[model samples]
Target: MTDHPRSGAHDRLVTSLGTSIVTGELPPDSDVDPVALESQFGVSRTAVREALRVLSAKGLVGARPRRGTFVAPREQWALLDPDVLRWRFADRVDGVFLDELGEVRLTVEPTAARLAASRRTDRDLADLEDALAAMRSAGEKDADEQVTADLAFHDALLRAAHNELLLQMSVVIEVGLRLRDQFVHGALTTESADKHAEVLLAVRKQRPKAAETAMRALIEKSIADVEIAKKAI
Candidate 1:
């Protein structure tokens, strides 16, 4: 994303500040020291300000008259923002957050699968099949590819549901999914592929109830994988 010196500085400042804030090093309502940031990061004042503005837009920081800029309360943060999610999971998986993400997936994915069964088109089926095939072909050495394909499969399933709001919700879900995959990718087995296959098959067969059940099982398996991976870590 950073292609130039100035942008790189801005990004570095943002990433540093954001990580600090997310990790509670700069706890809520703490002052954001632009001068210190500029000196510490060797970034220009413009770069520092620009980074602050970006964080502000993401609800990570806010300014008040006579008070300068400060980190916002957690409730004010855009938790679903990709940057925030990345920061949260960048160093290590937050078990609580990961469990919360799993809960969301459990609640939404099964219903999404049911709708997909009734709404999916031939193209949707093809896309799901492609993603499934990618998953199956991804061996232990192909962790990155496995993650991408796994994400693609869920994305295809969401699209198959034909709901605009659900599609938008995937924006948030995708971030957590990627992080979880990074941790659990090594734990994937033929059974994992088989579970996804079950969902795909149900969608392909247009069996709403079966699709729902399969998706629930798939997500449950994913949650179990994360639990296992967390212990391994």
Candidate 2:
């Protein structure tokens, strides 16, 4: 239990460092020392080392032969690591990662919407409803709560579609959530939440074509929003 809060703080530091890397705040190929990093973050040396270890595991940072810890080049980032993904997404909302993630979402989510339209069971609809309700809770929810609700909304829709390939696409959702973790605000916007409602409405109404269209629109809008977010940098 004693380690719980400490563990969380360590994770946050790792995440913040990851954010710094992906956003170019910590430039590629730069050298880092634990003592310097510890002082910079105002954490203990052990915490700093542990956070660096976490980054190393995610392939964002590496220990050189004797040059000390160096920030990996941009190409070395483990794009699939959840931590990496969120950092990338949150790093600079206007980046190529947002555009790329949006493009992928367009390809994957509409199809998932179509499947859920045809195969979604009643319980699946209920789950979707629950997610929608959570989203409407007015005021910024916690980051984890946002991730959970965002993911739950997507997962419930995927389940409703019931295609084995669609079900297999859960990995994609996982990737998206990782991208979301870098946000200073709640993971998604009210606009995105509104679009999510449209998707849910189409699915609940059993309009497969409508659901597919709505899902597509949502993806397009999210892409636009991400572009806007990137401009803030």
Which candidate gets the maximum lDDT versus the true structure? Answer: 1
lDDT of model 2 at residue 169? 60
Candidate 2 backbone overlaps, count: 8
Tell me the TM-score of each prediction against the true structure: 0.91, 0.62
Each prediction's RMSD over C-alphas, in Å, is 2.9, 6.1
> Which digits, one per residue and each the tens of the lDDT, describe model 1 over residues 115-151?
9999999999999999999988995568888878888
Number of the predicted model whose TM-score against the real structure is largest? 1
